[model samples]
Target: MSEFRKCARTAEAAMRSVFPATPLQLNAHLSARFDADIWLKREDLTPVRSYKLRGAFNAMRKLRVSAPDQTIFVCASAGNHAQGVAYMCKHFDVQGVIFMPVTTPQQKIFKTQVFGGDNVEIRLVGDYFDDTLAAAQTYCSEAGAAFLSPFDDEDVIEGQASVAVEISNQLGSAPDHIILPVGGGGLSAGVRSFFGHSTHYTLVEPEGGMSLAAALETGAPVSLAHVDGFVDGAAVARIGDKTFARLSDMNLSDVLAASEDRICATMLEMLNVEGIVLEPAGALAVDALVDVADQIRGKTVVCVTSGGNFDFERLPEVKERAQRYSGVKKYFILRMPQRPGALRDFLETLGPEDDIARFEYLKKSARNFGSVLIGIETSSPQNFEALFRRIEQAGMTYTDITNDETLGQFVL
Candidate 1:
């Protein structure tokens, strides 16, 4: 066995003292849909509701063992990583200072504090994560504290490799394909290192945050100009330097960029259909299965459900995104005649299945015309086509704003 595999095995054993291995269960629903043997490596079921705890525990344990005098540890994260570090800080009885973006959800901040109890101190630093990370590093240096990188450090990668070890042991052998969600690349790189060529690997990242894909294409890590925060858990601007070193040789074709809207749709499906709650990043692997349906068919495939740290407050946004992606909903602006019974005439243009979700009268653009911002929900995308055609035939004009990002943000 390779050095990484050996160290990963040791980390797996050490993890039992903190938490038992997460489940690797066959997903019948996904299997039937994809015509494959779909197994879910349920990292979401961990104590911190993420695989992040494994890395945090391994890194913190090694630090404490190597430097017994070191009692303070620091890290910066907006979500799962913060909770994991806080949990381990409590376990190691060490003080942990966690810095998170000021815009981080209050639910995540509260959970981190609860997990660490008195051992953790949360500092809401900057609005942006880069600013927050810089502030955390500065504080760690000034305080003579150990700094923990969520994915870049060697120890954290070794710890994350434990997930692969557990999956192989539970499955009785290496799976034909292991699909992993990539953020800074800790979990995917670690897992890949442990298995090597013994198992085929597929890496998934958020469509708006294709850091891993960027690294593979450029032969080195490069910062993306823009990153969509929709898949907050896995949306990283750049892949970690250390993690990318391990992934540098990967096939670029195997790197799948999962759409953020599609991820939200997957999240809803897994929740409603399978009773499995997956965050957007957690759903990446499963969502990528659509792109690999043919290759994975009749093969044993594992999709790592990486995190379940979903905030229920985002449910409305999740539902909206899902609807938009599934084409069951739409938004548009209607030009109504500024005369009585014109509203009734416009109402008649809607199909029987179409329901008005939102309607607001904006300013009158002309003496005879007024702008009406409208949202319509229906049973199918085809319904919108029929509804729009009827409106056109009725001598009225409208603009489809469902895909207009700038306009939707302002009016919807």
Candidate 2:
């Protein structure tokens, strides 16, 4: 075995002391759909419901071994990494201080507390992640505590390599393809380092936060001016410098970007079809399979479902996005004439399968015509085509705002 793989094996052995290896299960639903051998590295089933705890535990364990007196660790995270660190702190019987954005959901905060128990102190620090990270680093420096980076640290990278180690051992050999979700790129970097060119890799990122693509284009990591935080677990503004070094030579073609709404559709499909709940980031790798279906046909492929920290409260929004992406739901602005029976005429245009989800007048007192906001849910996408044809044939004026981002944000 190569030196990197050897180290990864060591890391995997170390992880057994903390938690058992996450299962690598053959997924019949996905395999049959794509006509390929599909396996899922179920990192979502980890004790903290993510693969992050491996990295945290390894980093802290290494620190303790190298410096027996080092007992304080600090970290900043709003999601999976925070819980991972908290869980490790409790297991190692060390003091850890975790800083999170004040805007973090109460559910996440409570989970972190429950995991850390009395071993870690939770600090609600800043409104944004960057601010929270800065505060954590400053506190760590002042208090002489070690600050554990979520993805930028070498120890953390080595820890994450354990995932690859487990995969290789479980499968008996490397698969034909591996799909990985990229954020700060720690997990991808570690996995790629361990496997090298033994298997094909497809790295996926959220369309709104393509930091890895930006880094490759710039020949270096660069901060994005804006990032859509919808995929909060993987919506990093910039790839870590350490991670970029490992992925610098990766082909840009192998990197895919998944749209937020499309990812939502994938998440909902896993839940409704397979009884699997995945966070947006967790579903990214699976969602990217659509872009490379031809390349993976009849090949053995593995997708790492990174995390399952989905908030059940967001199920409604997830369903809404899935419906919009699937074309079963839409919102439109209609110009309705202020004459008698105008409303009746509009209602008559709807097909039997069409249902009015929302109908409200933007302006009710116009002398000639009133602006109305309407939402429609239909049984089939073809139903919308027929409905639109009827509206056009009747000389009714309407604007489809379902895909109009600015207008949808304001009214829909």
lDDT scores in order:
0.93, 0.93
The digit string of per-residue lDDT tens for model 2 on 1-412 reads 7887787788889889888989999999999999899999999999999999988988998999998899999999999999999999999999999999999999999999999999999999988898999999999889999999999988899899999999999999999999999999999999999999999999999999999999999899999999999999899999999999999999999999999999999999999999989999999999988898999999999999999999999999999999999999999988878888988999999999999999987545637888788999999999999998998877789999999989877776
- 1-412: candidate 1 lDDT, tens digit per residue: 8888999999999989989999999999999999989999999999999999989999988988899899999999989999999999999899999999999888899999999999999999998999999999999889999999999999999999999999989999999999999999999989999999988899999999999898888899999999988899999999999999999999999999898889999999999999999899999999999999889989999999999999898899999989999999999888888888989999999888999999998556558888888999999999988999999998889998887889877876
What is the C-alpha local distance difference test score of candidate 2? 0.93
> Candidate 2: RMSD over Cα atoms?
1.0
Off by over 4 Å in 2: none
TM-score of every candidate: 0.98, 0.98
TM-score of model 1 (CA atoms)? 0.98
Cα misplacement distance, residue 202 of candidate 1 (Å)? 1.1
Error of 2 at 96 (Å): 0.8
Which 10-residue span in candidate 2 carries the lowest summed lDDT?
Answer: 361-370
Q: What TM-score quantifies how close candidate 2 is to the native fold?
A: 0.98
Mark the 10 consecutive residues where model 1 has the least summed lDDT.
362-371
List of clashing residue pairs for candidate 2: none
